[model samples]
Target: MDKDFWLTKWASNRIGFHSTDVNPLLIEYWPALSPKGDEHVLVPLCGKSEDLVWLASKHQKVIGVELSEIAVRAFFAEHFYLPLVTHIDSSHVYYEFDELEIYQGDVFTAPLSGVDLIYDRAALVSIAPSQRYAYAQRLCSLLKPGGRILLITVDYVQDELAGPPFSVDAEQVQQLFPGMKTMLLCRQEADQHHPKIARQNLTRFADEVWLIEA
Candidate 1:
């Protein structure tokens, strides 16, 4: 998968991955991270996710990096937020509204740093496994020392389906972020009744939440 793929996905509204509601796991586990409430939170590959709104409520600043300009504008429009837009560079457009800021560009190239907490609800899983190492490296560079990540990942049989939402189990998570202190926070069995899993005919699907300290 590449930038054009995601840009096409957003332009075509083929966004089954986009969630309308705040993730329950985030609500339950974010507080355990014990955020200072003045910290800068980063949400990567954030496609107008409602989780960004929730994070903005809890933090002094919430920065999201998304590739789709369509998604970025939709976010502020949906929330009735009139953001001040600026072209940061050829690769990036910056949008700011109140406590929320979104960089509409490629995650790897976006100018990002000093992130206190990273909320990785769907970012990691969306990357092709071959590129996850690069993704992890870029994220680590953006994060401050002692920064924390509240990451949610899904695990399933890779051969069972072609995926943008790929199977990234505990071991792969460790491999992706070698030497980072990772603690598994929770695991929930994926609902077989859910249309995504049901159609794929996956026998085992589970979501794991992890707290990573850098």
Candidate 2:
């Protein structure tokens, strides 16, 4: 998958991954990071997520990078925020508001050198396997030394489903971020009652969360 894949997903409103509520898993695990309420946090591939609002409410500053201008605009609009927009570059635009800034462009092009925390709810699993190693590198590159990551991923038999929430098992997570101190925090079977899982026709699905320190 390339930029067009995601851009088209947004354009066509095909985002089954977009959660209208703050993910309960994030609420449960964020405090484990022991945030001091004054650290910059990066939310990658954020697609108008309510979690962005929740993070900013609890943290110092929240930065979100999204590929879709429509998603970014919708994020601000949905939050009732009137952002001061700037044209960062030809490929990117920036939106700034109280304690929140969104970079609208390809995530690889966003200038996230380092942040104190990263909340990777769907960012890693959304990418294809071929790009995962490089994606992990980029994630580490953007986090400070000793920075923390709260990552959530899905694990399932790939042949059973074609996915944006791709199957990223524990072993692959280790291979993806070899330099980090990683720990498995939780692993739960996907809810069969959930519409996405039902639609995917998956009988064996695992939803996992991990904590990583760089």
Candidate 3:
């Protein structure tokens, strides 16, 4: 997807991908990773997700990278926060409640260091297929050794539809991070009866939760 594609989505409020609540899979598997105090967690392509707020409550520093300014603003606005804004290189930083910081720019172009954990729910699969490897390399580079990543991906037939939420099988993920210790945390078929899937005419969809240790 191009920058204009996402920018238009945010501009028109066409964000069906944005969940209203924290993801249940994250809640279920996060403790297994055993993140410690004040450790920084990175959220790539984070589109004003409520999960960041949930992580912040656990006393973890949350850093989210988003491409759209509108989505970034909506995150703080909807949460009733007025973030302390600053400019860092080509990106804009929005810090709020002393726990969360969102950077608005391309994730590859952003400067980041000291990331201890990664929470990837919709990020990896959202990118174009050709870009997934580059995205994974960038993500792996940000992590400190012994750090972990909680990655979520979808599996389905891609010929049926166009995607901002693309389909990525487990093998591709393993190939992306070749030497890392990757484990399949969970795999469950998504509820096809739901209105969301109905719109897409998706016959089958499955979610794969992965734990990556460096």
Candidate 4:
């Protein structure tokens, strides 16, 4: 997908994928992963998620990489935070808000490392299938040895609908991140009552959650 597609989505206020509440799945499944306080957590393609705020309170530092500066600023502004800002480079800006460190830049190129845990709620399912493997590689590379990921993906028949939340099955995930230890933490029918499903004409959808370790 073109980078501008997402930038335009933010520009035009078409981010239907963004949720109004912290994802319930994250809340229910995260503690089982056994987070040690004071570890670094990276959230890829983080879009001003309240999850970051929640995470900051628990972890030593919460790092998020996003492409939209608007989203980054709105995140702190909406929460009534005044961040200490710094320009990382031409492509990146850093905002230090409480324990949250949000970087506005390309997720693929961010100087991200030493990530003890990764929270990937929307990143995986939000891109084209052709990019999924590379995305997984980038995600895994950010971790230290034995680092873990809390991942969520969606699966559906391609012909049934188009998507930013594209269908990615178990086989596809394994192909993308070979040799990783993985456990299925949750699998259920996606909320069919979601109003967008009717508008998109989707026939079916399934949500899958995984705990992945390198």
Candidate 5:
């Protein structure tokens, strides 16, 4: 998938991936990181997610990187946050209000570093497998030493469905992060009643969460 693919998805409101409420898994497992409430958190491919609001409550600063301007604007508007906007460069725009800041542009080129924690709910599974190594490398570059990543991914038979929520199994997750230590925290079968599964006739779907430390 190309950049315009996501831009179009946001513009046309075909955001089946967008969650209206905070993800339950995030709430259940976030505290496992023992956040001191002073770490800088990064959320990549963050599409106007309610998770940003929840992360901000737990961290000193929560930074989100997204490609779609519509999604960024909608995030602030939906949250009733009037952000100070700044043009970072030809490729990026930064929006900030209190502890929340979002960079609207290419996540790979966004000017960011020294993140203590990275949250990847939708990012990893959303990328094409060929580019996931580069994506993971960029994430490592953005993190501080001893930093951690809270990642959530989906697993299913790829031939059964075309995906943005692609199947990224534990073995691939380990390979993507190469030298980093990966710990699987949860593995649960996908709810058969979930709209995507039911509509797509997905016979086997599972969700997994991991903690990766650098």
Candidate 6:
């Protein structure tokens, strides 16, 4: 998908993929990373996720990169804080509230060389299949050596569906992060009662979380 796809999604309020609360998976799995105070964590395709606010509340510095300006603006606005604006190359930097900073531009173009940890809940799977390899390589380059990456992906049989919420199984994740030690932390069928996925015709859907060390 191109930038316009996401921009339109945000503009039209077509963000069913956006979670209403901090993801339970993140709550249960993130502490395992043991992020230290002042260390920077990268959240790619962050949108207006409350998870960033949750992380920041714990004294961790958060750098979130998003493609949609609407999502970026909504994030700061909804939080009742204004950002310190700056331009960086092709992206616009919005830094505010001391804890969170967002880059409004393509994630591939955002500078991420110094990121301590990568926390991706919706980033990777949201990209189309043709872009997954490039996205993975960019992620690797952005992460520090020995740094950790926390990824959440979905597995389902409905490959025919046109999706921004794409399907990515464990094997694909392994191939994508070949240089890192990849371990599955959790895997369970997504709740059928979940309002978002309930309408899908698929028999079963699984959420798999992986911990990758660079």
Which of the numbered candidates is closest to the native, going by highest lDDT? 5
**Lowest lDDT block of 10, candidate 1:** 190-199
What TM-score goes with each of the models? 0.97, 0.95, 0.93, 0.94, 0.96, 0.92
lDDT of 6: 0.84
Lowest summed-lDDT stretch of 10 residues in model 4? 190-199
* Pairs of residues at least 3 apart in sequence or in different chains that clash in candidate 3: none
Judge candidate 4 against the unseen true structure and give its global Cα lDDT, from 0 to 1: 0.85
Q: Tens digit of lDDT per residue, candidate 6, span 1-214?
A: 4788889989999998888799999989987777777778899999999999988887568889888888888888988987888877656565556888888888887755588888999989888889999999999998887789989998877464556678898889999999799999999786778543687666668889999998
lDDT-superior candidate, 1 or 6: 1
lDDT of 1: 0.91
Candidate 6: stretches off by over 4 Å: 89-91, 191-198
Q: Write the per-residue lDDT of candidate 2 for residues 91-177, one digit (tens) a residue.
A: 889999999999998888786667999999999988878888888888888888879999999888988988777989988888888
User: For model 4, what is the error of residue 61's alpha carbon versus the real structure, in angstroms, after optimal superposition?
Assistant: 0.7
Show where candidate 2 strays beyond 4 Å: 191-199
Evaluate all candidate structures by whole-model CA lDDT and list the values in order.
0.91, 0.89, 0.87, 0.85, 0.91, 0.84
- Candidate 3 lDDT, tens digit per residue, 1-214? 4778999999999998899999999999998789886889999989899998999888558999999999989899998988888877656564555789888889888777869999999999888988888989999999999999999998878887777678888888889999999999999886967653787787778889999999
Candidate 2 local Cα displacement, residue 73, angstroms:
0.4
Model 1, 63-113: lDDT tens digits are 999999999999999999999999998989999998999999999888887
Q: In model 3, where do residues sit more than 4 Å from their true spots? A: 94-96, 191-203
- Tell me the lDDT of candidate 3: 0.87
